[model samples]
Target: MARVVVDVMLKPEILDPQGQAVQRALPRLGFDGIAIAEVRQGKRFELEVDGPVDDAALTRIQELADTFLANTVIEDFTVKVEPS
Candidate 1:
């Protein structure tokens, strides 16, 4: 079996309120020295395939991501086959 990873993130132009909240709380949580400039939170989806991943499978996964997993208007996603 093989694993595929999907990383979904907000587009650069969009505002990430959840990420901003986390960033604001970092200092209060005793993480002040990190010098973090910004934080954009996102989602990850892992798919386990029954066999080797091929071009067709990748295409299908991409379609699935575009159709059901992410908001096309405000988010972008990347799909990669994980090293087994």
Candidate 2:
């Protein structure tokens, strides 16, 4: 079997209110000296497929990421295939 990892994130031009909230809270939470200029919230999906890692599987995973895992209008995604 193989594992496909899908990482989805907002576009750079988009405003991330949740990420901003987390960034603002970090200082109040006593996380000092951490130079975090910005933070963006994202989603990670791990999919286990019943086959070896190959081009066809990667293509299908990419399709899934594009069609279901991420909102292509305002978000982008990357896929990684690994051994399960």
Candidate 3:
């Protein structure tokens, strides 16, 4: 088994109203000297699979990303496959 690390963050040009709300509230909540804040959404899923590094597994991983791991409409991600 191996650990798969996936990370996704909102595009910089996108509006993040939730993050903005948090930023606005910070000073009022006694958080001093605040500059800025940005929000992003992501998740990490750990699953067990048996295989050596091969063309087949890499293709499967890519398919997983395309089918389920990513929201193509709003986000992008990179997956790192590591040995256990």
In terms of TM-score, the best-performing candidate is 1
TM-score of each: 0.97, 0.93, 0.63
Per-candidate local distance difference test: 0.96, 0.90, 0.67
Itemize residue pairs with steric clashes in candidate 2: none
Instruction: Name the runs in model 3 displaced over 4 angstroms.
Output: none
Poorest 10 consecutive residues of model 3 by lDDT? 38-47
Model 2 C-alpha lDDT per residue in residues 1-84, reported as the tens digit of each score: 768889999999999999999999998999968799999999999998886878887897899899988999999899987655
State residue 13's C-alpha deviation in candidate 2, in Å.
0.5
Model 1 regions more than 4 Å off = none
Give the worst 10-residue stretch by lDDT in candidate 2. Answer: 75-84
lDDT at 75, model 3: 64
Ranking by lDDT: 1, 2, 3
Per-residue alpha-carbon lDDT of candidate 1 for residues 22-63, written as tens digits (9 for 90 to 100)? 999999999999899999999999999997799999999999
Error of 1 at 9 (Å): 0.5
Candidate 2 displacement at residue 48 in angstroms: 0.9
